[model samples]
Target: MNALSVIDDLKRRFPNEPEYIQAVEEVLTSIEDVYNENPEFERYNLIERLCIPDRIFAFRVSWVDDKGKVHNNMGYRVQHNNAIGPYKGGIRFHSSVNLSILKFLAFEQTFKNSLTTLAMGGAKGGSDFSPRGKSDMEVMRFCQAFIQELWRQIGPDTDVPAGDIGVGGREVGYMFGEYKKMAREFTGTFTGKGYEFGGSLIRPEATGYGNVYFLLEMLKTRGLSIEGKRVAISGSGNVATYTAEKLLSLGAKVVSMSDSDGSIYVPDGLSQEQLDYIFKLKNIYRGRIREFAEEYECQYFEGERPWQHVACDIAMPSATQNEIDGDDARALIANGCIAVSEGANMPSTPDAIREFQKARILYAPGKAANAGGVSVSGLEMAQNSQKLSWSAEEVDRKLQDIMTEIHKQCVKYGTEEDGYINYVRGANVAGFMKVARAMMAQGVL
Candidate 1:
């Protein structure tokens, strides 16, 4: 199939859905050569099928606030593909949730799951309801209302949902409890559950830790080490903090962390004590990153990201999608940043990626780098199925191995003539080949 033509047709059909279009264009363009090399894929129209979701579930979620007032929100579930295995992805709860965003996420999830070498498909669901400033009871009621409509469509062996940006362990627990009450059976319909339930060990730290592991592998190719390197990280959530914790344990200096409000830069590098304070500030108190700047007397930038301003040996964008643009990438390269390993999906824009590739710097896309979260979610599914839970060490070891294998796949497919590894091309081609072959073998289903 002609990649540009398909993208044009998609844009025409899906007007105003820039996120989904961008995701589809990126993958299709990256895999165009290999996709054309396979005649069966074109004959079977696999590209068309792969780009469109298998099904979409949209419903209304109505709940009562603490004031006993009623509110209604739109919820959605986009099951993109399940040719390989069951549908697996996160359930985000934010005001930004929409068909376009969820579709983009589901499309990305398909390849991300494939890279994990797991028998899982791509899916994403969420609501337009924001969890910020909501009380516990309000959140619980909203989750229950969401599951009331969703329980009939999902099962452990069908579609399993985890937590995303606004949905955390608390939200997962609330939704799982509602599902259990409705289905009358305790199964692994959800991951990232509380440890007291069927949750797996180190699930929270898996993504961040796995990102570092992948970065270390990339550094190994250039005869470099993370030790003594100054690192700039974005986001103060689970992914960013755990990434910082792991880096510190490995002798790296973490120089920055951020939130929705702004970023905090500690030029001297953050200490364990400072990180602990950040943990309390963000996790416990649910405060902003500026609090850390105030408490530690560091530099704080309001309404800005931590990329162009921070001078570091490494950059990790763990916040959100399209955070690092071309200018930020150019600045990072100009400031001598050597590597970037994404902890959030699609955090780097297309121009930024081009900048990284032009500079020949070690760069990893979110699908390959930030896949540890879903890799561990896959593990959680296995544990729940077998009624067994692995120890923290066992789970951590498996995560490391998965990240290593993903890096190997990227290198295998992404290496250039001059020896610079194009991880974006590598990840897209590798992931697309697997799903394309599977779709072809399944015979137009």
Candidate 2:
């Protein structure tokens, strides 16, 4: 039951993968105590089995641009595990794609998938093609090429990829088209497709909605509510957008939202019209977050980061990994930031997590907090198989229910005798137990 021993085992097993090691290190630390209390986990050697992925696939992708030029990109798929079902996660098309990052993501996805109580496994794949300023034709070509080699390795019953950062509905559509053309069959090979296709409702907002729903459970456990609570969210993507929508719907006042460029503060809650415009700009137009401040009358900052001198009751880091560092965590704590739940993957660094735990602030990891998207992706897979589609409200209700259940599991397993919830421990233990049992049953696959 020694966490350090498990970490040492992982360290030796994965010497070349610092990112994977870093991501799983905290979980190992928490696993020691959980395994001590629950003898079955340690008896089965679950930690050793779950630390490494089943397979890692990397391919070279070459495509031509509009200017009579060819570009080469690297595509990777990390199939973390397959005990429960086929590999399921998002395909992110961004320049930042790397094996280590993908491995870390896939590793986290194993537990995230288990937390959803779904029959999906863990996998993530993508390329290094940055879609930021690419023309539509260029994107289409890139996606087509990316899927050409990928098509052979993926399928509905093999691995289903959704969309992630820099990969929106546009990218999903392009990839799905190519996949269909190459595979010559219409199946749920991908989730997060356009609604006109087989994509399920509420997939776009599921991650954000799930995050707030999980936070709501945490708040409710502490006899608190979101009503009239000033909140700061640090993203403008699908996850951030729907989170904003859900927060507003429940009477919470969102003070600020941001993107990679900068964050903007609107003392008054963002109106529906403003939210609509921002959604169009980011989701459709591929616009930037700073435009929200320029187009609307909100307090704005440029060429900088968020977590400045603002004060709020809750802070949601919806942007990329490590956006909230130790200093940002201190700033939040100083400004009465009582809770933080990540909407983006690894949004908070190790130091930021320590700061929150030191101050006894409610904190939830992205794996558990932002699991709604894949949960709904699982729903989409179900719809595809059953040939039945649910309404947005139905999907949203399921998402809320799953997220609330995850929070309760975290509290039930992670709370101290004094009722202080350590969601990190709770999520790690709860997610680990399911995956470990599955792995043990499967016998070393």
Candidate 3:
């Protein structure tokens, strides 16, 4: 009846995918006793069935390029759960995505959204379509075509998907416009829209900002602050940039950031001008990280990960999943990395997580750390439902509140036998309780 047993039983019964099972096992092993003690959840067999999705949709997305050529990609939608509300998650466009990854994300999202105290269930969908090197018109056309088939399976109050890797505001607009044209219902069908078109102003910066907010809370508990702390951030995308910005505003010196290729380190702390240049390179010009080093007059290491560069007080992994492995974790610990907060889904593998916990570093999982994105998405949903938009300051304040509340809940429920709080367990248990109660209240379908 323990949470570990619940996941272990799934692993045994399934006995098909070892990696996936191990991932679930790591999460469950963190909070096994809670599941064993919860009578309502146990009575419903929630733990055993929580890992399974309700429906999985797969389709082929074939789009023609401007050069009279056709390309086909596989798409997936995993509706992990909907007991509390509709499915809500992001669609990632990466070559590495598959059914297993999407299912893991959805399962994690079910808890992540619940932790935000938002009435959103869990689901994720995307294609293995790489948007890089494609023309704007080409990407738009693909998005339009992608949504054409996906429209039937989603709606405002049903399943809402936002953008992830290889997808952005333009793609969201194309998909939203297509969905509206097809359904003839202009509702909050999708989030991450442009601000003028029902997107929340803070949504773009929410995940990064939220990760820092959670970190600030963690530091506060230990009577520490981000002041003068050296921060090393991975990924030069929206999450990493905004996270570094927030940390900089809090008086922390951000020393390094990376992309897929390599990393850059500046001794005098990164400047806003450099970040503006980075945005132009990545968001506007779609350039690489090597260019980042050239413009900033910094040291660049090609074919090297960010964690191995140098020491820092805080480490934020805003990059893709499994970016920080055990080696990276050990390096961070050795280099005096005090806090590790994830701005991307499952950025740290199980081994990395174990290393961090063993080192007693303040660690926040992406589900809880990055909840700010969907938290603002929820705010967007409210604005759409009420036909009103709040000011940026108001939205940002609310976001801080949401992140702080999540931190409190995690700490409240995640206390370990040794009095050390495993944020992963705290996040999962806090989220699970809310969703399970909601599901129990709704009765089984």
Candidate 4:
């Protein structure tokens, strides 16, 4: 497979979809050698087939506000692939929800799910309805309307949607309730549901905890540990919150957390009190990071990211895509930062990733690092199917085991002659091989 030719064609076909093009280029470039070694893959046109999604559902979601104002927003669901099992992914509800971003997410999910060793395929859906300042009723109405458009496309054994970005337990609950009312069934059509319902234990904390676990494995490669490490983490959402929680318990000093508004740097590290406040502020009250800075009297950088300012042993980008650019990567490397494990999807740009790879620092891609949420989602499906709920300890044990296996797979495929583990290459190759074999066995669709 000629990676450049395929990328060029994709660029021509999807000129406006830079994110999608970038995602395709990354996977195709990483898997080119292996894909070429098997001529049958080329004859079957597997690369192109995998680049495009199996189907995409676009629709309009109309909801009413508290003042009886009718609002309309675009909604989408991209089912990327189902060669392995049923479709599975998240529903993001940020204003930035576009086809390009969802397409990239679904494409990335295809491989991310493959790495989990779970029987799941790849899919993603969301809408442009920003729930930032909306009241609970407004958000609930929007979620219900959003589900009204695509409820028929998802089911317990078909597609299971979870939470992402702006979607959370509350949003998932609203959607699931609407679906249940519409379909008259109480099934696990959605993961990340409220614990009172059918939500799995530790599902909310899975991504963050999984990221830290993957970082632990990476640290073990150098005979190091997370204890005593000063860490700088971005974002104040579930991923960053639980990442800091696990890190604090492991004795790591978490110095930073941020939001779209800005970042706060706590030079002395955050206390449990501070983290608790943040959890309430963001989750319950829907407040900002600046509020935390004001309460804790920390240095807050408005309209800026936390990467260039925080000097720490580790940097966890749990924010958004393309957040860490080339300059941020160079700053982290120059500041003697040793490792970076992403808790968000595609948080680092290609240039930033190149910087980390050139520096030989332990850098884990989001597909492998941030896959914990979906891993637990797959487990939730299992528990729901059996009509049994696992204990928190049991679920956490399974999550840790999955992360360790993902790391071992990365090492097996990504280890280089220089004794450096290229986790990005390792993850992509390992994930691709699994999906490719499955697709091959199923024959052409």
lDDT of 2: 0.86
lDDT of 1 by residue, 169-255 (tens): 999999999999999999999999988899999999989999999999999999998999999999999999999999999999999
Model 4 alpha-carbon drift over 4 Å, by segment = none
lDDT-superior candidate, 3 or 4: 4
Question: Can you write out model 3's per-residue Cα lDDT over 1-445, one digit (the tens) per residue?
Answer: 6655567677777666554575577667765677767777778877666778889999888898989799999988888888877899989888878777787788888889999887899988888898888998888888888887888999888899998887789889988999999999889989999998898897889989999999999888789978999999989888988898888788899888889889998866787778778878888888998998886668998977689877888888998878889998999999999899899888898899999999998999988898998899888888988989999999999999999999999899877788787899899889888877777787765
Per-residue C-alpha lDDT of model 2 across residues 1-445, encoded as one tens digit per residue = 6767777877786677766777888778877765677677677766666777788889999999999799999998888888888999988888878887888889889889989999999998888889888999999999999999888888999999999988888899999999999999999999999888999988888898899999898898789999999889988988888999999899998888888788888877777778888889887788988777877757777855567656889988887877888998999899989999989888888898999999998999988999999999999999999988999889988888899888878988899987789899899889888887777777754
What Cα-based lDDT does every candidate model obtain?
0.94, 0.86, 0.85, 0.94
**Which sequence of candidate numbers ranks them by lDDT, best first?**
4, 1, 2, 3
Q: How close is candidate 4 to the true structure, as a TM-score?
A: 0.99
Q: C-alpha displacement of 115 in model 3, angstroms?
A: 0.6
What's the lDDT for residue 311 in model 3? 81
Model 2 segments beyond 4 Å from truth? 5-16, 36-45
